[model samples]
Structure formats: C-alpha cells, structure tokens
Target chain A: MGFIDARELPDGHTVETDVCIVGAGAAGLALASALSSGTGGARVLLVESGGFEHDDHTQYLHQGQVVGREYPLGISRLRYFGGTTNHWGGNVRPLDAIDMEPRPWVPHSGWPITRAELDPYYERALAFLGLPDDAFELEAWTDGKACRPWELEAELAETEIFPAVAPELRQLGAVRRASIEESANVDVLLHANVLEFETDDPPRAVRAVRVATLQDERFRVQARLFVLATGGIENARLLLLSSSVASAGLGNDHDLVGRYFADHLVIPPVGDLWLSDPELPLDLYLERARANATGRAMGRAIFRLPDGVQREQRLQNCGVQLGPTMPLDVAIRRGKAFRSLDYAWRAVQEGDLPDDFHYHVANVIADVDELVAGGYRLASYRAAYPTWHVDLIAVAEPAPNPESRVRLGDERDPLGQRRIVLDWRLSPSDQDSVRRSTDLLAAAFALAGIGRVRVQMPEGGLDWFRPSPHMHHLGTTRMADDPKSGVVDRNCRVHGIENLWIAGSSVFPTYGHVNPTFTILALAFRLGDHLRGVLA
Target chain B: MTTPFAVRRRDVLRLLAALGGAGFGAGAGVGAGAQAEAASRETLVAARVRLRLVSPESASLLGAAYLRDRPDEDSPAHLAVALGLDAGATDIAAIAARHRDDLRSGRVHRLDGFGFSRTELRLCALLYLTDRA
Candidate 1:
C-alpha cells in the first residue's frame, strides 16, 4: 500500500529499491504490475512525473520546439500516470514480419529482434490490454456470417484486420491504478520528475536517479537496476540531460541516442471510393465487428499490399482505411471548412496571426449552406444506398532517417530540464511510397471490379500530397545489434550502461504502419520477464 | 509500321497511368500485329457516332494499350464479343446507358489496370480498328 507523492516528501530524502521503473506509462505500468505480481516478485519502485490526474505545471514539461516540420510536440502526448494511453484511440495490431526485416531500399531498417522472438509475448500483451484473444483475421471476428471482406486481387492488395480495445477499457492508468497501488512489492511515486541519472565515473552503470518535484522538493531513488519507460522523445531527452559522467550523455560513446526517429504518415481524404454495388457486405470492413467467441475486442478491416508485392515494388508498408460515404459536395464543403479552420487554429496556437483568417472565415460562411445540407445527408445516407461514396485515408510507414531526430533544446523547463527540439523530417521516399501505394490501390480497386477511386492531389499532382505525422513517436532510442547503429542493444540495455535499460516504442528500430501500442507492450512484458530473472 | 493515324504507345501509357490505370506489358511502341488490323470507313463512322464521349484519338490510344496485353482481343468484333457488347444498339445514348448499367451490374472488362464496362471497351476497340484502317 504505497503511493508516495514526491511533493510531500521531505527534501533530500532517499528511497532504495530493487528496480526503479521511470514514467508510469503503458510500459512502466506493465513493468511495475508484472514485476510486483505473485510470490518471489521483485520489489519495484515506479516513478511518474504526473499524478493520477493532470496539472498544468506537469503538462508544460512536454513543451518542445518543432523545427523541420510542424508537429504537435506539446499536445501529441500526455504526461499523466497512464501516459499517452489516456487519450489513445486503442487501435492495436502487431507489426508485420516484413516490418522487422531489413529492406534493401530503406536505410537504417531492420530490428535487432525478430517478430518470431516477440510472438509469444504478443498474446500476453493482448491479455494485458484487456483483449481476450489474439485472433487478427477478419473472419475470426465475423465467423463469415455478419459480413464478408472485399475480395481484392492478392497480388495487388490484401486485407489486414485491426482490433481495438473498447473506449471504456482503454485508459490503463484509470483501469489498473487500484491493482497497481495494492501490489505489496511495488511503491508508486507521483509528481516525481526524474532530472538526471547519476552514474559511475565512466557512466558504466546508473547508481541512482535524481528526482525533483514542481514544489522544489528534491529526492533520490537508488536501485540495483533502472528502466527508462518515459516515452520515445522523453527517453532520449532524459538520456541527453544526464551529462554528469559521460560528457555527451549517458551511453553516448557512439552519439546515436536521438536518431532514426519515425512516425506513421497520415494523408487523410487521399481519394474517394465509388463502389460498384451499393449493398456490398462491408460490416466487417467498415463498421467494426463486435467481440467474437473468443471474446476479442471489436475489429475492423484495413487494406495494404501483401508483403511480397511490397518487396517487389521496393515500397514501404502503407495501409488505407475507408471512411463513411457522404455526398460529394458535402465532403468538399466539409473538407474546405475543416482545412481552413485547422490552418487558422494551428497558426493561432503557434502565436502567429492567422494568415488569411478572415478569408477562410468568409469561405466557411459561404459554404454554410452546403455544409448543413451535407450534415443532413450524412445522417440519412444509410437509406440512400445508390449514393454511397467513401473517402480513403492512407497511413504510411516512415523509413528510418538519421536526419530526423529529437535533440535537447537550449530552453529549460520548470523542472530545470532541457526541453526537446524535434526535427521530424520525412525522406523523399516516404512520400513516394504513399503515392505509389495509393496508385496501386486505386488500380487494384478498379481492376477487381470493386470500384473506382478518384484520388485527391494538390496542385503538385497525384505524385504529391501533404502528410501529417500520426503522433506515434518512435525510434529515438532505437535498438540494434551494434552500438554505433543504435542507442540500445537487443536486450533494450543502453549499450555502455550496465544497470540501465530502455522500454517502450522509443526502442523500436523500425516502426510499422500499424499502431505501436501492441508492440510496445509486448516488448515491455518481455523486458519484465528478463528483469525478473536479474532481480531474482 | 507507322500509319497516318498511329498514336505513340508512350503517350497511351502515360495517359493510362494518369487515369490510375496500370500500364503493364510491352514497352513503349505499338505492336506490328495491332498496326496491321485496320478498320473500314463504316466502322470509323459508327465508332465515332457511338462513343462520342471518347474521341477517336483518345479511344485509339487507350485501345492500343489494352490490346497490347491481350493480343487475342486484337479483332474489334472478337473484342466486342468478349466484352459482351455485340448486342444490337440504337444510338450513342443507348450505348452510354448500357455502359453505365454494365458497370453497375458487374458486366465489366479489365485492361492495363483500368476497370472498363463492356460497351466502353468495345467502342474503344472499334475506334482503334478505325484508326489502323
């Protein structure tokens, strides 16, 4: 029964533990819960910067500058007990085998660990995520009764199923707080911001983590082992902040800490799908199917190229999701209004006067009639079968780029820690892959007699489209077999550090097009098992 | 093998690619077999009258690319039979209506990655035959 508030702790207090897990996100929580469960479980200390709920001061620590492209550095993630899972949409799927393999076309690709090595832990991870089973096929959810998936040409495109935990059970911090708090072997520390890692003369091992609170309460947590489960960006930031022993940073002998950053690129409304049959059985693909016999969560179908085709085309993995059909004019009006409003909002958020704000407002006002009509049509579109038109949204994999990185900014946060500067850039091939993949999808849909697709392109044409990062920060502390190529080794241990390990998507070497949460937890559960042996 | 009305195959491939069609097969030039199958003046007039939506030049370009993959469908009448477009037709509106109906009813032909209705493919084939003549 230990849930310590660092703000209330006396100054200069020291707490000793067997294992100190930092940042109580999905990975941290999973590790804490796993390490503290059952007899012979290790005594664990879990530390989180934020408490059970959020406060402004704690959230402000996440503020960072975006130099390469406009990214939501501050808002993309939350700094609460559950971490970003607090607002996660709950889409979960394991990476395809091809995602882990090194492709000749993609630079800095390949994972130190294979999918086969992580397969056993995926089921456990699913259970941890409150999913009953790990059946990912479309028929598994439908039993071939409720609906049938689109029979696209196998050579061109294949159906991929993604299961999602229900919204009610998504937030791990809210759901597992009681169990985690009740664990006798674990002590949870709230509002404890880890400032630096104090290591030996050569920084070969982490002796203790120097922590502070917003209230200026300073404390220390010494442990036999330390795990940084903060996040992709924060993990790298903290490592860079710990400059006491290693001049560059802890485990910075190779200077590979905050490189190879990647995130799935989302291009919304890339095209419109005109179905040949209005009554096509699209329940499994469109509206998500409910829990099946195995009690798996709701599942929906996504489309992507088969692995062989992707390799043959020398393309990165790109997945497409279909949105509900609406009237063409309504879609146009809605898109225009939303795009203008989005631009204005982003400009305002960046502290710049919204350029053409009045013009966009005027355009929106002029589009009011069509927008209202579209909203009404969308509500009644179910009855009007002949007018079905769905928009295609592409979620593409980002190739590992060394230039795309997260670095320590000059500005210091309230906790006196350097804020991060994220230069998240996409390689030219990244956009090319999406364009080629979308074209192939369009052709495949037409040739299969499925439908025609009217692809959306800017003035730059079909070959180009503006892409937004899908808020999935990955590969900042990438894992590899060698120290020069990655910050962490195959076991997620910082290469030069003996007692320090990294967890979560930050260690993902090559992030796949699907959501990263499933793989993140799988790695965490695997790490938990590994640390259990070490602690024993 | 150049004819007065011969359209460059590269132009056709580029157009097909732009139309979201897969231009898979032989490289950039018309095959001698396709160049040899010439259409009569009557066929050209009928094709122009029937497929007014597609110009003779554009239809010839699209049809040449389509036939390059399926050499067996080189003959305009044979291609028409294969596409189920050999039925009696009254006017351009009837052919257009049938094309739309065919697309809706799954009576379609696929070539160079573009999904084509039977009526549309047959009209294009006839236009190609006319261009060769």
Candidate 2:
C-alpha cells in the first residue's frame, strides 16, 4: 500500500482501482480493511478530504445555513482522515428489532432488511469495535447481576446495556491505520476531495469521480465500484451536486435524494427519582469498570420501553438512564463559603442585585449546615467509599419527516462547491413520542413503589420543547425497496446507479434511539462482504 | 414522683408539639396561654389520634426512643428530633403556642450546630406537624 497526497500529484493525473471508497471515516475505513484481507484480493482506494489532523480550511467547507432552529453546522462535523470519530463519545448500542419494522403511527418507517438478517454482521461489528461478543445482551455482559429486584417489577421498563470500548482504542483510523497502511491491496489518498461523479450516458452507472485538490490540481479516479461513505449530510450534498445527466441529481428521479433526514433527540433530565432504599446497589445503572477476557470494558445500563408496550402505546422507541440531579436553588446555595462570599461581593460591586437576590441570600444562609455536612461527606468518601443519586434522562427516536432535509445552497465553498442548507424539522408525532413515553415511564415508576417522577413539560406544551440535537445525523439518503420512496435500494445501492453505493447512517430509513456508529460499522462490514463476493 | 420512663415519654410528645407549632408562627403563642390550657386535654387526645396516622415502623422507632433505647439515627422519628427540636420539653400545648408565630412565618433558626440539610429539616418539620395535627 502507498499513501499519497493528492496535492503533490501532477496535474490531470488519473488513478484506476478495483474499488474506490469516498470518506475515510469509520464506515469507509472498515470497508477498506475488510476488502484488503478477504480472499477476493481486490485493490482498494480510500479518499479523504482532510489530512491526518484537522485542518481549518477543510473544516470551514462544512459551514452552512440552518433554516429551522439553531443547529451548529460548522462545528457539528469535522472533515478529516478519521472524520468525526476523533471526537465521538464512543457510546455504542445496536438498534432494537422493532425499529426496523413499519409502524402505522411512524410515517415512512421500516428498514428493507430485518434485524435477524443483520444479526451476523452485528456480531462481527463487535469485534471491529473491540467490544466483547454479545455485549449488548445485558445478562451475558453483566454475569446475571444486571437484573432488577422482584419488588420493582414494571412491565413497561426493562434494562438495556450499552457496551463501549475504552476511549483510547475506539478511534477507527488511529487503531487500524497501521494495518491499512501496511496492506498490499490498499492505497490511501489524503486531500483527494471528490467534486463530482462522471457517469455513462443516461447516468445508470458511474464511470469515474473527478477529484480536486486545494492547490487547484485536478484528477480522476476510475473504479469498478464506488461507495459514498460520507456522512448523512455530505452524502446527500454530493448526490445533489452531480446533476449533469439527471438534473434533479443522479438518483433523484423521484426527488427523494435529500429527503427524510432524522437525528436522535436527546432530552436532558425531565424527572427526579428518590428510591425508598438508598442502599440498593445501582452499579448497573451507573458506569462501571468491568474486566473481561480481552481487557477492561465500560458498561452502563438504561431502561428501554418493552416492545409490547411500544406496540400497544404506539410510541417510538426510547431509552431512559439515571443521572444525578440537584435542585437549582439548593445547588447555588450550597457552594463553598469563599465562592459564596465572592458572589456576594460581585453582586455588591455591580450596584444592584438581580431579582430574588434576598431569597437566594436567605437560602445560602439556611444551607450553611448542609454545606459543612457535604464537605465532611466528600472528605470521608474520598478517604473510603462513595455513593450516588440520580435523576431520569431519556433519549427518544424521531419520526422520519420528508420536510426535514439538506439541500445545496447558493453559497460556494473555497473549492467552488456549493455549501449545504440543513432544514432540520421535527414532526408532531416526534414530540408526542417523547411526551407519551415519559408519562408511561413515570406511571411505571410509581406503580413499582420505587418513587415518583416529576415530568418537566414546557409551558407552551410539547411544541415548545426544544431539544438540542445529539449530532447523530441519519436518513438523508434513506434505503428502501421502492425507488419513489428512497434514494438507495435494499443493498444500499443508489436507486438508479449500478456501481455506486451509499454507506453509514445515511441509508438508515428510521433513526433508532441508540447511537448510530455501531450499526454503521455492521452495515459497512455487510457491504464489504457483498462487494468481495461480487468482485470475485 | 414520676418514673424517668414516663417523664421521658411525656417530654418527647411535648417536644414534637412545640416543633410543629414553631413551623406555624410564634405570634400564635402570645396571649394564647389560657387557650393552650383550655386545649391541653384536647391536644393530648389529638396526639393520640394522630399517632394512628404514623406508620407502624415510625411509631416503633419513636417508642424505642421514649424507652431510652438507642434508635437508628436515620429513622424518621429520630430525624425529626435531630432537626432543632428539644426532646426534653414539658407542657406540649404551652410550648406549641409559644412558637406558633415563627412557625406560621416559616422562619427556621439554627438552635443546634448539627449538620442537617434543608430538605431533611423540612421533612422533620413536616413529620412533627403530621403527628400533632
């Protein structure tokens, strides 16, 4: 394998390979690694827009407008060799089986493939992610210690385990970069930004991709097969940009290329829980260090609504986790004495205090005893053991809406490419899912005699509940069996293009509550195997 | 002379009533000494009736304290006692009336330097009121 900087290549250079994969993120890197080792022995070319480290010029290319709500477009994604994996939190869990099935309530829901079909690939993906096999099965990973007590039996809620690899070993490029660089069948090209796709007459098959460098160098990459592994937003942007033959875009004959965009809506702590027995071991609910045959792994348990409950209630899939919560008034009053003094001094210097200044002062005075007690507890816990209390936090699936999409904008980047316009919208059903799920969870908790849950609803109802996006971009170029409904086919191939395929979460028809990286790897591995069989 | 056991039980009841009154207002005590005397017999009857409302576990815990046995400090009854209430007071109705004004105003004063959180103190005040109501 040889590493090449496309900027250094001569002008009008052309490279030919058996398979060319665009975007060296988790999906692209995984596919390249898989193809290089298989018995088919096909040559692979992985193209990345940015260098090894982040470059400001390349990152600025992701800047765009957000028509609905304030989405941090420029800062949400990083354009580099490793892609956004460099900064990901490494929370990995497979989507539930029901997420793939069509629901009457969820519009444009259902995956062309079922969970049973993807099970083998998910098992293989565990190895790629460095997680223990069958880690997502709570009983197997926790050695049967993850069970809830009989006294707290609630049919609506069940624990789901998330198995995450250590932070240092999770980066795809950093962990597998050496093997990829050493492989004889792979060639990695940095700074090779694919500008447009050149296709045959009628644009049924992509012939080659025109590449451009920041220094104005031009080249072409001809391949037997092409996979666009760019993220959710960029995948649609690239397809929309290639409009030579199909004016609507290569696979946009039905005008579905950039439609049906979705992302996981993460709602912060909406309720508080006070357990009757504070001494119960909640280690499963909290992040714990576990020793397995391989090495140390991190595990955290979350409560998911049972499939039966979701079907009966007609609600979207959601998961709830326990997190520590303190009343805002108490937290402010319980600061260190010196910090309180400093705050009081600052307020005095400002000439006038804000509203409820006297009330806050009274609270601080009232909390002096608690402050001293908390100091002792902190010192004692540091010397010996510790305790934890938590509130309920939830993540819910967003119903797919064609109105939420990404389109090519008028403004062009430094490379003369039009930037993207992200119009992220949430449908009424999406808001209903969060509200209904939270209410059910609260009822279940009260029924179990665990405690009461105080749901925090916005003053203006569910419509006013503004949740910050979790950056898990999904479903721009969604996959389906029919061309009129989706951009990609069942095998992730662009509906009309023969040799071109789409990878990553962009092909996901529904955005499950779980994080997308693990599933992305599974799909990539499955695609890699498919390509190997085809090329052989 | 009353035995120490009987005296201790009476003392605990008086303290509970005084703590409850303190949460209402101290002004409720002024010029109410005659009224408290009038209500003393009724207050005792009220305390007996309210004792039925407390959970059996809480009642047992309070009984253990009255018997001079070391009850669990985390027990609800002991928690109420630890939150600035004198456990050795006499005359339940008089002390309750004396602290009514401050109690009604929700004024909390740190009589003892014991480290109790506001939540715990509030819970203690609530327990006392529930018992005396």
Candidate 3:
C-alpha cells in the first residue's frame, strides 16, 4: 500500500490505478480494507483531503475551531482520512429486519438490501474494527441457557429493557493505517482532494480523476472504477457544485443530488429516578449504564416496545435512560418539580427548531438529592468520561419531511464548491410523532408503576427551543430502482453515470434512531466487493 | 404501591454528594435554600406548565433566560441573560434552541404566559402572559 499526501505534488502528473476512490472517511477506508486482500494486485487509490490527526487541522477544528463556546453547531464531522470515526460512540448495531421493510405507516421506506444480506459483512466489519463479539448471546454475558448480560444487576433492566452495542472506541484511520500498510493493492493518499472527473467520449465512462493540493499543485489518477466517498453532505454538494457538462449535476436525473436531506431531531429527555435495591440495588442500574451503556449489555439496553403500547400504536424505536443514583424522594405525586435536562430533550422540535436541532436544560431535580449532588451528576461518573455529564440525548426519529432539506448556499468552500445551506425541514407530523410517543412512553411508565412523566413541552410558555445536531444525517443521494426515484441504483452507482458511485449514510432513504456505523461499514464492504467484481 | 412523593432536602444533597464523589463534597450540598430560592424567585414560574412561543422574534427577550442552558456559550440566551431578559416573552423555537445548551449545563429560567401539552404536560409556547393562565 502507498500513501499520498495532497499537500505535496508540486508538479502535476497523471497516475493510473485500477480504482480511484475519493474521500478517506469510514466508507472509503472500509472499502479500501475490504478490497485490500480480496482483489489481488488490483490498484486502488484512496484520497484524503487532510493529513493524519497528529498534524491534522481537523483534530483541532482549525478551519473554524470554537472550543468551549457553542457556536452555531457547525459540523463536528472530521474531514481527514478516518473521517468521523475519530469521535464515533462505537455502538455498532445491525439495522433490524423490520428496518429494511417498508411499513405502510412509515413514509418513503425501504432498504434495497435486507439485514440477512449484510450479516456476513457485519461479522467481518466487527472483526476489521477490532470490536468485541456481539456479546449479546454469550451466557456469561447473559443468562445461563439463554445468554444474557454479564452482571446480575443488568438482569433487571435486561428482563425489562434489552440493549445492543458495538463498544469499540474505534478510530478508522488507525484501523486503516495498521491494515493498509500490509496490503499490496491499496494506496492511501492523505491531503489529496479530488478536484474533478474526466470521462471518455460517447459512453461517458469515467477515465480519470483530477486530484489537487491546497498548494495549487495538480495531478490526475486514472482508474476503471471511481467512488465518491466524500461523506453525505459533501458528495451531494460536490456533484451540484460540479457543473462542467450536466446542468442538473452528475446524478441529478431526478434532481435528488441534495434534496431529501435529513438528520435525527435529537429530543433529549430528563426524567426522575429513585431506584432502590429493596429487591435490587441501585448499583445494578448504575453499574450497567456506567460500564456497558448499550455496548456491553449493562446500560441503556435495546428492546422492542410492544406494538399498540402507545395510544397511536405506531411502530417505532425505544431506548431508555435511568441509572444508579443515591436513594431520594420522588415528588411526582406531590406535583413537585425538579427541572432536569431530560424534560426538554424530548420536545425540542415541536417549535421552530434550528436545523442543527437542540434543547434547553430547565433543571434536573432528582427523586433523590444524592443523585443530583454526586451519584448522577455527569462529573461524578468514573466508568465513563466525566465530560459527557450534561443532558442525556434521547434521539427521536425526524420522520421524512420533504421540506427539511439541504440547499446550495450562496457561499463556497476554499475549493469554490458551493456552501451547503441546511434548512432542517420539520413539520407537525414530527411533533405529532413526539407527542404520541411521549404519551405512549408515559403510559408504559404508568404501567410499570415506576415514575409518572411530568413532561413540559415548549408550548408551556416563553421557553426558548434550541435544536441540537443528531449527527445522523442521511438521504441526499438515495438509491432506488428507478432513475426518477433516486440518484443511485441498488449498488450505489449513479444511475445515469457509468463509473461514479457513492458511499456513506447518504444512501439511506429513511433514518433510524440506532447509530448507522455498523450498517455503514457493511454497506461499504458490499460496495468494495462490487468494485472488485467489476475489475475481475 | 407508588412511591410517596416525599422530598427530603438531605436526600437531594446526598444525591449530589454521591455524584460529587470522594473529591468534591461541596457539590454535595443539594442546598434547600437554593431550591427554595429557585422556587420563590421573582421570576414567574410555570411549574409543569406549557411554555409556547408566539414567534421566533420574541424568543430572546422574554424566554431567553429560560431557553436552553449555555452556561459558557455566546448564544442568544447567554446574550439575553446578560441583557437582563431572564424571564420575559419568548417563542417555542427560541426556547428549544436555548434548551440545546441547557442540556449541557442544567440551567433554568421563567417567563410570563406559558402552556404545556394536555396529554403529556410537555411545554409549548403561545405567549409569555399565557404562562400564568
């Protein structure tokens, strides 16, 4: 494997490779790794806009780094070789079998491939990322015969709330750095930006890619196959911004280059808890949430909420937050109130929320004072990083709102590429979903006889509604069977274009609450395999 | 049986103390005085009431202090708080945006006229004067 830094290359030269892959993020790196050994001696070029994080400007957010002060949540996404894997929460979950199915109730729903089709890739993905086994079915980690969580306290929550995890704090660059060095077929290029694409006459097969450095040096890399793995927002922006021949852009037959843009409207919640070990210790929930937190089967487990549970009975997602804290008095009955960040996290989008959606923390009054003072305060946690103490984000699905989308802003990046103006198109349908979901969860809370919900939606008064980023942006260049329906075909190749392909969460038509890292990796592997087959 | 809604100040303090850990007992004082101060502040409190906004324009002046908790950001709420709009009129979107920062710091504020949803009691902003009625 060879690494090329885009900052170098003072003289413009044309290099030939079997495949020229653009953008060295998770999708590109994963695809490179998948093909590294599979396609023997096949030349694969992996281009990154920035250098490694040690000297990387992105690590410090140098372009527009505003540490401490929360400037308008300009993307926390990294642009270097590894991309966002630098700060991923590492909770790898397979998209549920149902997620791939098109529910009559769910709008614009479908996954061209099923969960079963991606299972093998899921296994290999976990292996490549150096992640622990699913740990979901091991008996020591679970009940004796049935396989369960490893700890005793986890059983309570597990019996009631099942959670899944990917638990590896993986840095994709490190994974690629270690793996690519041993590969004979891949070339990982740092700081190599894909400036433009050159196609052959008539058929329009991509013949070569124009690579450039910020230093004004230029070069070319020719390949049989080309992949635009430049992330969700950038991929679409580049195509729309790249108006050399096509007026509507590269894959704009349906005008879907940057249209159906989406991210989860993160509705964080603050709820009260006074868990006692009368039959089980508060330590059980605490230890689970503290240690495992959905990855190790201890905290924030994943489980299916019985359908028809909510009044609307809509098929939806469920992940809970209630952990170990010192015993205290729950004033739910007294109509007592302690403003927890939890309250505002849920109803953040009902109002005219920001595109990078968020909410305010009123106050978090614990049923027990000790939980607030120490046991529950973010600064007190030892198992997890203390800095993650603030509002617990209870991510909610921002149902497909065709209106909430990304458009080309009047601004441009350094490359003269159009600046993306994101308008988080939301509607009453989203709020309706939240209200109904809240009602359903409250009913469940009532049934469990735990604590009643004291929800205070934004409509209550003159409370400011600040929206936060869900970090799960998807669906600008969706894949569908028809050219008119989506920009790409099932394999993620641009419908009209011969050699252009896309990678990332962008291809997803519908956004799910579960993190997309695991699924994203699987898709990348599939794409890599397709590329190899083409070369063969 | 449902747990009785009995709130003990020590229980509150103990909760904070546990979170503070062996290092900072100062965080342990779940100060009842502080709670009482918050409860009785001159701010028009809407304990579990709907907090709606009429528009994005008024989000800063009335509901700025009560929007999202920034604690350290240079957002409108931080600006409004600095400008003395702790408990004034605000919009639902403004409150929600401000709340984005509040989640990180657990800050609170109150404005006039606010309302909450009928089903789950979530906040919804119509106008500040509506907070009382």
- What is the number of backbone collisions in each predicted candidate, taken in the order shown? 0, 14, 120
The predicted structure with the larger DockQ, 1 or 2, is 1
Docking class of 2: incorrect
Alpha-carbon lDDT, every model: 0.75, 0.70, 0.52
Those runs of model 3 whose alpha carbons end farther than 4 Å from true positions after fitting are: A54-73, A138-169, A200-204, A270-299, A302-312, A315-318, A323-393, A458-467, B1-133
Best-matching candidate per TM-score? 1
Per-candidate DockQ vs. reference: 0.06, 0.02, 0.02
Expressed as tens digits, the lDDT of each residue in A1-536 for candidate 3 is 37766566666787888887887878888888887866867888888877877444333322332222133335557777688787766665666566665656767776676778888888877676554455333332333432332132221222233233333446778656866877777888777767666665442566777776666578888888889887777777667755566666677756778777766555555232211111222222232322333233333343233333321355444343442232222222122223334334434634534343322332233344533454344344333321111112244555555555555666545655456666655544555555445444433332232323444345432133333556776788887878887778889898878888888888877766667777788889999888878877
What is the descending DockQ order? 1, 2, 3
Chain A TM-scores for all candidates read 0.89, 0.88, 0.76
Share of true Cα-Cα contacts across chains kept by each model: 0.02, 0.00, 0.00
Pairing residues by index, what is the TM-score of model 2? 0.73
| Residue ranges of candidate 2 with Cα displaced over 4 Å | A140-154, A325-389, A458-460, B1-133
Stronger candidate by lDDT (1 vs 2): 1
Worst 10 residues of 2 chain A by lDDT: A381-390
Clashes in predicted model 1? 0
Candidate 1 recovers what fraction of true contacts?
A: 0.02
